[model samples]
Target chain A: MDAIRTEALTKHFTVGFWRPRPYLALEALTLQIGHGEVFGFLGPNGAGKTTTLKLLMQLIYPTSGHAEILGRPVGDVEVKRRIGYLPENPYFYDYLTAEELLEYFSALFGHSAAERRRRASALLDEVGIGAERRLQLRKFSKGMLQRVGIAQALINDPEVVFFDEPMSGLDPLGRRHIRELILRLRDRGCTVFFSSHVLSDAEALCSRVAILANGRLVSQGALSEILAVTIRGWELVVSGLTETALAHAQSSAGIRGATRLGPERYALELPMTVPPEHLLAKLVAAGATLVSLNPLHDTLEDFFVRQVAAAPEERGLESTRG
Target chain B: MRAIGHIAVNVFRESVRDKVLYSIVAFAVMLIAVSYLLAQLTAGQDLKIIKDLGLASIATFGLLMAIFIGIGLVWKEVERRSIYGLLTKPIRRWEFILGKYVGLVLTLLVNVAVMTAAFYAVLAYQGWGVDELARRAWPAPPMDPALLSAIALILVELMLVTGIALFFSTFSGPFLSAVLTLGLWVIGHFNTDLRNFENVVESRAAAWLARGLYYALPNFDTFDIKAQVVQGQHVAASYIALSVLYGMVYPALVLTGAVAIFSRRDFK
Candidate 1:
């Protein structure tokens, strides 16, 4: 069974004060997510990424259509017991310490006191919140609170987890830690679905992805299928090159983008049509040393930008969809 | 039920750690302490004056606690976006609404209990008469357990206030909720006036409007047995039981309404 499925799920919000009009927040967002896959829900701000997660989590009712998780309806209590959700910009009662917050959440799931204690301690430690676990959440940094948010979501050890912008508001190291955590969750055979505009993180972590633009699913498929993962080009960093040779490489038609690194070094990007060996031989004959060569491919960000840019500017907004 | 308990306990913990609650309790305690000193100036009415002031302090502070804290019970969760995490849990929407109500009620209970304990401590001092300073004739025993019956009614009244506050909080913002709750509290205490409002007014429609409101609004005067209990007059056991039952019944209905409204709400 699919870990999550939505059949023409849509949402419309009534807006305006005097003359109310319907605002389309999410279109007919029919999608399927299989078990044990890290499905990336990618969209720009206000693109209905959070709205979709809210729909799946049953925080808001869909205007029309239905959603199911773990082969059950969206609001099934038993299904909820097997799933975890981290909301966008997670907020918690700042009065309680991290341990107390987790314990309280565990209690909601009916965990025993001893089990709550063990889980809270272990999760807090695992999230790198050591001594700070004793301090109130109000004292925690945004990144620290994000960590706490993840720990609480995992406290139930859910089979399917949904996270909304999990990598937002984190430093580089913090982002890396969360990335590793997502990979670890995937390794455990847990179906992980997360919404993010951070395409690089999605690129690194997602096996499959769905891109949303203006409340519409613009594109979705396997990473390798949707993106050209094959080497599109190669970058050769050359050093000790003569000025005349550097100018020749810069003016070469085959070299797409060339940049001068330093006094005697230059980096040249060549398309797949241009063999790196030919460039190397030419550069070596011109008394240049090849520092290193690396292959480049199409990134998720490249696809995402194109998709969002090409998508119509919110089509059929005047009419309603069911 | 278990989810409700967890949410309630967390709310109680949140209330316990709040500095505002401490400030309110401290001010109420100080007012009760001042009541004792004020009673010394009255001749032959010290006991009456003290009991009146003490009960008044408890009721006013308890109402303040109920209105202020209760108004935020749901509003805070939604405003801070904490409800998003909670509604996704393995609990029903009615459970969330019921849990919030129970938690705020529990917090108000603790506050009322603390204030009641302080009031009793002052009464204990009056009874013990620190260092043989006693020898004053009293209208009633200073340490009256009957005071609890009055205090219990006050708690019931606050419970009603909490339920009404929560009811508004579910559908409205805190400012509007507070206004509506305080307005209802004021009208509730003067509920008798609404019943007899026809006598003061000339218009028949206004009188019927008043009569309609009389039945529609809570009769909070039912819980006010402070004067009878203070003056050592007999308070009927049946009356107290009926008032408590009414108090419990009203909030249950209000909470049901609250759950209905909250269940259909979108947490945007």
Candidate 2:
């Protein structure tokens, strides 16, 4: 059974104090996420990423359709036993210490006192909370609170975890820390579903991805499949090239173009059809030296921009993209 | 069951840590002490005045704690977005509402208990305050156990107020919730007028509306025994028993509404 599945799930929020109207926060969104995969739900801000997570969490009711986790319907109490969730910019009860917060959540899963203590202590350490720091969460930094949020979510040792904008509002180091933790969860064979507007973070962690724009599913598949992981071309940087050799290199059928890098230095952009060895041999014979040769593949960021660009009517909303 | 307990315990701990609870309780204690000075100004009626004011202080302050803190019981979780993590847990939505209500009631219990003890202490001190005054006021000894009956009803009233606060907060922000809860509390004391309201009103629709509200609104005045307690008049045990039953049952019904509203809500 799929770890998570949604069928035509939709939500419409009645906004405005007066003359309230139903605003389509999320349209019919259908998704199927298999077990034990790190799936990234990629979207720009206001693209219904958080709205989707809230629906799956059953924090809000769906206006139409339904969802299920581990073959159980959403809002099933038993299904939550196997699932965990960390919200965007998670806010815990600041009156509680990190351990206290974890322990409290542990108790919700019916853990024994000793088990609760053990789980709280272990998860706190796993999330990088020190043993000596028993300060209330209100006193902790944002990064520290976020760490506690992760610990609380994992207190039940869930098999599937949902992270709503996990790396949001974190510094580079903090983001890296969460990225590594997510990778570790994936390594443990836990299905990790996370929403992220930051494509780069998703790029390094996701095996499969689903791009969402304007509350609709734009595309979904393995990252390599969607991005069409083919070598676009080679970036060839060379120096010590004679002017004749440089012009000859630019004239080559495989060479896309050449630009002078500096004195006696020129870089050539080549199509994938260009043979690295043949180019090197010809360039060597012409008294040119190779500095660097690297293949460039399609990037998720460019693909994301292209997808967003394709939807012009909705393009205006992309101005607030994160 | 366990989830409710956990949420309730957490709410109690959060409320205890609230400086507002402490400030209000401390202010009540200070006010109870001030009652002694005010009582002295009345000469012969000093002891009676002290008892009356102390019970009044307890009821008023307890109501404040119930309204201010109770309005935030569920609203705070929503505003802080903490409910995002909580609702995803292996617990029912009704459990969350029940837990918050139980937790806030527990906090009110502790607050009322402390304020009651302080009030009793003030009465004790006045009883032994002076030689001539002590004998004069000692017809049956100053600290009557009947005062506890009044405090008991007051606590029940406070619970009802907290439940009303929770009920409104399910569908409204803290501001509107407070206003509505307080409005109900004030009108609850006067809703007995609605019993006779149908008799005075000319319009049949207005009478029916008044009767509906009379039945629907909380009857806070039913719990009042302070006047009888202070005057040393006998109050039937049956009256307190029925009032307590009504108080417990009313909030439970209101909380049922709260849970239904909360369950249907979209926390967007």
Q: Compare the candidates by TM-score and give the number of the best one.
A: 2
Model 1 has a DockQ score of: 0.69
lDDT string, candidate 2, B1-268, tens digits: 8899899999999988889789999999999999989988986788788888899999999999999988988888899888988888889999999999999888888888898888888888888747874566544357789999999999999999999999998888899999999999999999899999988989999999999999999999998899888888889999999999999999999999999899988877
Residue B131 alpha-carbon offset, candidate 2, angstroms: 7.5
Winner by lDDT: 1
Stretches of candidate 1 off by over 4 Å are A229-296, A315-322, B129-138, B198-208
Native contact fraction, candidates in order = 0.89, 0.89
- Label model 2 with its docking quality class: high
DockQ each candidate and list the results. 0.69, 0.82
| Structure candidate 1, residue pairs in collision | none
Return the number of clashes found in candidate 2: 0
Q: Supply candidate 1's per-residue lDDT for A141.
A: 94
Q: What are the per-residue Cα lDDT tens digits for candidate 1 across B145-246?
A: 999999999999999999999999998899999999999988898999999999999999999999999988998999999999998888999999999999
Candidate 2, A192-245: lDDT as tens digits: 999998899889999999988777788888998876665688888888898887
lDDT (Cα, tens digit) per residue for candidate 1, span A1-322: 8999999999988876798978888889999999999999998887889888888888889999899999999988998899999888899989989999999888888899999999999888877889999999999999999999999999999999999999978889989989999999999999999999899998899999999988889998898888765568999998998888877866764788878899888888999888888778888988999899988777888888989999878553443221
